[model samples]
Target: MSTTVTPTIKHTALSDFKEITKMRLSLSVVFSSVAGYFLGADTISLKIVLLLALGGYFMVGASNAFNQIIEKDLDALMHRTKNRPVASGRMTVNTAFLIACVFTILGIGILYSINAQTAMFGAISIFLYTSVYTPLKTKTPLSVFVGAIPGAIPFMLGWVAATDNFGIEPGTLFALQFFWQFPHFWAIGWFLFEDYKRGGFFMLPTGKQDKGTAVQIILYTVWTILVSIVPVFGVTGQLKLSIVAAIIVLSLGLVMLYYAIQLYKKMTEKAAKQLMLSSVLYITLIQIVYVIDKFIR
Candidate 1:
């Protein structure tokens, strides 16, 4: 006779699973992929949409889990991450690794059901995030640039999933999201500099809050806005935004830019937090507006 895993250990593992996966963050990334799918899909099926969401969530969860596994010791040193399941000793590295393996296999299989390209990109995003970006955090600020590649993939992944092709349209969408990540993440880095430093992660462009960092944030905000409105000029192949929708996107970009400018001026935690919120709003609303335009026009 053998004793089974106890309820206490089981419950702890379950809770630790959620903590290690960073469920909310994973879900947010999935939301971007869903928006991409909706925009690229000509005839949306409930089943495919659901599968995309599930696959996306699983992929991001796996990436986050692997990142935590790699950084468990470092995470234990930072107040922001000290309570994370693996960092807190609530879960073993072996358990986390097994969970990550399961999520990765399921995620890739689900995306493959949509298309091979989608599956391949999903795998790439996880690989970049876990294998590349995770290790670079402590080495160089250029890690943010490396990290943005994977970060930007989901938005275009949906388009690829729907069309089963990589073309100018998805490329444009990818460019827009890629540039947006700089300002979005830089704002977070600005506010959380101390917490990140505790973990030996230097994310800011200058690795400190200063004029140079603020200027780069503003510049990226400009780049993100320009890429977003390019479809209005009808340069892209599949994606074309109406003037009205472009105007709305432009207005939202201005709002984000305003916050970016404010961060440069104030250089305070409040301003950085405000910019972070604006970046979130800008991306979410812009994606929604684009999908709405696709349907309306």
Candidate 2:
């Protein structure tokens, strides 16, 4: 009985840790950073890749843990977030805070080993996410815009880690992710409107799902597609894209745009969810396409 209970306790603790850190979200963030690193790297170094992955994960995890800590009360009010470790009382606030502190130290230390710029960006991402964006969630819809800053940093952070220089290459990577977030997040806001409201969060640009919000989603999707193809024009320095890759990316973007347009026409929760899912696929596929093109071109 004692042995069986010990394993159960350990499993529960691990599950709680994953919940507080938002494991899946943190991993996706790490993927973006590693993809950027590959694009910027002249010759892939396994050590750098490992560092970027671990450091990026730790940093994102720390940011999310802090976000949960601040939003514990708010999270408790939302059905979607109610089961989170802190929100559900599965973990103490002090324990969560300690985990965040350790992750912060480890993330920054690991990134500093890569380069100062990478570490600096990681630190800034944490600060902006926890101190600014998290707080603004309950206050304004514009928090999505502010949140995009840190959200976009990981992609560019990888390039900086590889090159140790910030330029049009990294800048373009940043712009790509930055613009992409608006439509992606707003679609989520549209579908989860009621849940967000339960938490006192105003995430949509129009503060309600309407034609105005749909138009903004369509507009941003267009902008995201445009930014994605700009590297094919050869203006982005080391970040050039082949025509074949650009066409593939354009096709993917158009597919996502189709979903965005559907949301506009239907203005239904189902359409909004489709747009949100498409946005996720768009970002992931484009990152894969871009990295593959860099190698083949």
TM for every model, in the order presented, reads 0.95, 0.96
Whole-model lDDT values for every prediction: 0.93, 0.95
Q: What lDDT is reached at residue 66 by model 2?
A: 96
Candidate 1 clash pair list: none
Q: Which candidate is the best by lDDT?
A: 2
Q: Report the C-alpha lDDT of model 2 over 16-102, residue by residue, as the tens digit.
A: 999888899999999999999999999999999999999999999999999999999999999999888999898999999999999
Give the Cα RMSD of candidate 1.
5.9
RMSD of each: 5.9, 4.3
Write down the RMSD of candidate 2 (Cα, Å).
Answer: 4.3
lDDT tens digits, residue span 111-138, model 1: 9999999999999999999999999999
Consecutive 10-residue window with the lowest summed lDDT within model 2: 2-11
> Where in model 2 is the C-alpha error above 4 Å?
1-11
Name the runs in model 1 displaced over 4 angstroms: 1-14
